[model samples]
Target: MSVNSFLGVFAKSPIKPMIQHMDEVNRCAEALKQFFKAVYANDWDAAETARASVVEYEQKADELKRKIRLNLPGGLFMPVERTDLLELVSQQDRIANKAKDISGLMTGRQLQIPEPLTEAFDAYLIRCLDATEKAKETIGEFDDLLETGFKGRERDLVNNFIAELDAIEADTDVLQVQLRQDLRKIETELNPVDVMFLYQIIDWVGDLADLSERVGARFELMLARV
Candidate 1:
């Protein structure tokens, strides 16, 4: 039996998942800021606090996902589009989680960080997070963008944000290579697993930014047709 039919009286979901997704994305922004602060200050406590925030935000996003899946009454709304939105928002939350994971993983571990490179890469990380947050806020304009042409600050901001992400991605590639080379010279050993995990974290961050771009592209298409 269909869950909605089992529950009976299918009606519009009172919860605004779009708004929830916006809030979740904002939470990630704050978490990213905290993550950088923690690293700069070399304080694991701050990093832990940031991680806790990620969990709370993701929990709320997950709740919204469940609500949308069960109560959306397909065909009443843009079913396929709505499903994709939910998935994209979930991806953003996971991106935030990955940042938290990296912070925690490095926490308390004695790492030989080159002072200059450390500062530079940390700044790049913050820029990436900022771009992601802006793109996320753009996604919240689904209703307005669908009705009106992509003529709003949010849409413009997302475009610029994507450009900035492109630059950061390039810089990150350079920094990653530099850091790995430096480490190889100083450290006697490097674990493949740790290297793999670090790669995954960076890739996930990029994925978040990419998902936001996809949302913006879809919003533009929807605007053109609507």
Candidate 2:
């Protein structure tokens, strides 16, 4: 069941379809960026528009995942284990799900961004997006890993990519903490319920980065078997 060459079956490679799914995930991340920026500007309408994009991308990603899973070849041999690959896809899918959740919660509640928390929230969102971007890049290396049979210089390169993702996640963690502190500054000024939900949104943002980190960690585990 071993593949002769990944390029030979590029059309059928689960990796290829998975990459497309990751692309949609990245799009969700971008939409989040715009959504938050609009919120910062106090442009609720624009933020709602941006959130629509997130919802759309997330839905598309889910659709793609279903298609890939349905068409996934049984008993096919690859550079990485099939089960692990499926797990990786699930992990990546969680990121987009988190993005959608964050957007849905914010837009549904029409949560107003506090002026004092704007700066920190913006930075925090950017850091979370960075982690997701790095995760996408790490996933992009799958073709190379398959071509090289997950060995030699190819393995080293992916290792470095995973390490960079880890760094991004760590930086995002710091941003999350700072964002919470900033939220504290304006807690009294905001309605009690608003403050509670804002804190929840910040927590969800952190969850997004944490999921991205998990994607990279799972990738490392897959590489270990190689």
Candidate 3:
């Protein structure tokens, strides 16, 4: 598509920019899987490449966020409350922000997952990303929801997406606790500083799901007002 045509779409539909931003944010989160895989394999070169992709996606999301905030129309004719949509975009932006932080810190330190914890950590990361993916899907429904006036089947489908996002986040919580426990068991053998950073990384990864859940919560609130 031509640049004007693409830009015209956002002018026509406010939700389009938000959906595009979430797409980049989701890409940032999804990049972590490859990143962690390289980290686990002790391949710094491959890990660096994946981390770069994460950074690239994050930058794209950030740019879209700024544009959306600046150009978001303000009028009574808007499909949803302007404030609510802005708030939702803010929450969505954090997912990408946290993803960048995770990859930047891990890659900078050349961090390695402990042998025993690698499997569990990978699972935890995947489940967290799943929550992010679900959030993107949920947000993608907004255009349809607007069409249906936030009633009927489209609304039901959004509610189901939120419920699934909640469940995925809950799974991450459980996995987080288990990973922490397993980490604790091996903490004594690893360098104390590495152990400390590992715990921090664990918390940050969990934050991905936490942030995603907040996105769903924000959308749910928007739905409730209709």
Give residue 19's lDDT in candidate 1 (0 to 100). 50
Q: Write the per-residue lDDT of candidate 2 for residues 135-217, one digit (tens) a residue.
A: 89888888878888888998898889889888888888888888888788778888999999998998899888899889999
TM-score of each: 0.65, 0.92, 0.96
Candidate 1 lDDT over residue span 38-125, tens digit each: 6566677776776677667666655655555666554555423555555555555555555555555555352223454466556556
Q: State the C-alpha lDDT per candidate.
A: 0.54, 0.83, 0.92
RMSD of candidate 3 to the truth, in angstroms, is 1.4
In model 3, which range of ten residues has the least summed lDDT? 1-10
Please provide, for model 3 over 1-226, each residue's C-alpha lDDT reduced to its tens digit, 9 standing for 90 to 100.
3446656977678888888889899999999999998999999999999999999999989888888787777773855799998899999999999999999999889989999998899989999999999999999988888888889999889999999999999999999999999999999999999999999999999999999999999999988887
Instruction: Please give the lDDT score at residue 168 for candidate 1.
Output: 52
RMSD of each: 5.7, 4.0, 1.4
Clashing pairs in 2: none
Give the per-residue Cα lDDT of candidate 2 at 215.
Answer: 92
Against the correct fold, how does model 1 do in TM-score?
Answer: 0.65
Ranking by TM-score: 3, 2, 1
